[model samples]
Target: MSTYAIGDIQGCYEPFRRLLDKIHFDPVKDTLWIAGDLVNRGPGSLEVMRFLFSIRDSVIAVLGNHDLHLLGVAYANRKPGKQDTLTDILLADDREELLTWLRHLKIMHSDAKLGYAMTHAGIPPQWSLTEAAGYARELEAALRSDQFPVFLKDMYGNQPDCWHESLSGTDRLRIITNYFTRMRFCRADGTLDLITKDSANEAPEGFIPWFAHPHRKTVNDQILFGHWAALEGKTDTPQVYALDTGCVWGGQLTAMRLEDKQIFSCGCDDV
Candidate 1:
């Protein structure tokens, strides 16, 4: 038996499957931990969702920004932009089941025994792994409860771009969601630089990559994360894994065997 951590699929199902084949994945024995962005911007989101749902018990995934966008659009009637390609999923016969399952997916996942943790994006500098887990549960509780629709409506924003113990209501959930899904660069005090999406070298004058913050609380744990394809899986940090290799942008789909950290990839060829 083996475990593999996969990068953002972004709906590039063919390359995702090919990467799995490259790794010779066997559902019966090999489990998967996905860094999220399983849908949108590619041609096969519906297929990806269906397949993942089929093997739900063998897979663990955090929700990516795109994944949340899909939910917002689906349940909260949030409008879609031009680049959005989630119509197939929205129109699928199993859309309800798929979206429901997606809504319940975690924003952070960890295994002490495996000595690794996973999130769609990096944790905030202010949060230790323990705090991250608690925040994730709070967001998940709101998402899984009857108030989910209201939460989804409030979930879209870049407000309160910093963390504080005093944050409450939608403000708290929004900040928590941003840290787990949309974050990349931030200040030492955990203030997110939401407007900057460039590579680490180009981070704003007073900002640094979240994982590079001097006082980041998760330094002792290995972190697996996606959502910053601009890095192309490079952080120059041994314990930090940036798995989004831009498969939907014609890059490659990547997977790493957990036990040995060996990588497997398949070209997307822009779908």
Candidate 2:
């Protein structure tokens, strides 16, 4: 009856399965919290989505940037790039089923009893758990609505780089999405610096990893997140877990058992 939080799959189905096996996952008793990026840039996006969907009841996942990009390309007609590997999902017979399931997925998941929270990327330092949950709900509601295409259409961009209570319309939604799915580093003032892709050691001037901000509101909450594979599951800050090990980029797939905080990995063969 253990729970495991896994990093980004990014279509690396073989490694995903191997990691699950390494953990000796029992679907009937074990629950999985996925840190998102379940598809794209690997050879098995379609298979990965289908597998996750099949065991949907045993899993909880947040949306990652690549996941949203797949949605944008599917529903909003956003153009797929050369490296995009989501065509199989879009063209699958169960495409609607899979995408709809994905659209309804949470941007954040929390369990006070378990003392952990999950997001594709770190929650911004500005908001407390309650505020972050409310904002996540707001965006999730929009995504599940008929107006979702509007969100997908307006979802791109890094503008309005700071949070504000008064933000409305696409601007508000986009910023929230950015924080949940695309953020890595930010300034002390809560201004997001989305351009820096290096590890925390090389963080640019005036900016630091979101979890490292001294005033971060959710410091008491254990956060599980992906999207920054360069961290390689390393964040010196206590209780902040970086699970993405860049499996799609020739790194390993990683998972952590929640009860004992034990880590497991499987080498990826997708290179």
Candidate 3:
């Protein structure tokens, strides 16, 4: 019995499956915690989604930006771009089933037993693990609720700058979604800066990576995330693992065995 925490699949179904086979993952005895990006930007988005959908009960995933974008694009009646791989999914015979199952994924998963909090992107500096979980529930409820379309309708942007208690409507939804899905760098006071998506050297004058915030209280809990592919699978700390690895952008797909933190990765030959 094992629990495997995999990095962003990003629609790379072959690598995703090979990595699972390498670990000999058993749905009944072993569980999975995915960092998300289950679809988009890779060749097999539809197959990857269908495969995961078949085992939703055995898998736990935190929705990534690409995952949410797939939902929004589907609902908003948008078209997939040249680099987008979601057309395979949107045009699938079971598109409705796939999208519905995806919407059911939460944005965060934290286990005190495992001593880790897993999210698609890093959690905000202002949030403790407990608070992050609670806030995740708030958005998860909305995402799972009938009002989800309304929330998703206005879910994007960096407004409501800091966490404002009185934030309302789409503004509130955007703030919560951005923090959980798009957050990377923020100021010491915890205001998110979503515009700059670059390396540590270009972090502007005051912004810092979410993990580097001086007052962050989650240092005790290992934070596992999978955005910022430029990190090249480096979290810069043993306790923190950044697993994006650019699998969708022509890099290796990585997975970690949680009990002993043993890494299993497969190289990518095609983009």
The lDDT of model 1 is 0.91
Error of 1 at 65 (Å): 0.5
Clashes of 2: 0
Question: In model 1, where do residues sit more than 4 Å from their true spots?
Answer: none
Instruction: Order candidates by lDDT, high to low.
Output: 2, 1, 3
Query: Taking the tens digit of each residue's C-alpha lDDT, what string does model 2 give over 1-271?
Result: 9999999999999999988888889888899999989999999999999999999999999999999999999989899999999989988999999999999999999998898999999899989988999999999999999999989999999999999999999899999999999999998767999899999898988899999988889988899999999998899999999999988888989999999999998889732
Q: Candidates 2 and 3: which is better by TM-score?
A: 2
Q: Report the alpha-carbon TM-score of model 3 versus the true structure.
A: 0.94
Model 1, span 110-144: residue lDDT tens: 99888889999988888899999999999999989
Compute the lDDT of residue 135 as modeled in candidate 1. Answer: 94
Alpha carbon lDDT of each predicted model: 0.91, 0.93, 0.82
Once fitted onto the true fold, the runs of candidate 2 whose alpha carbons sit more than 4 angstroms away are: none
Q: Is candidate 1 or candidate 2 better by lDDT?
A: 2
- TM-score against truth, every candidate: 0.98, 0.98, 0.94
Candidate of highest lDDT: 2
- Regions of model 3 farther than 4 Å from truth: none
For model 2, the local distance difference test gives: 0.93
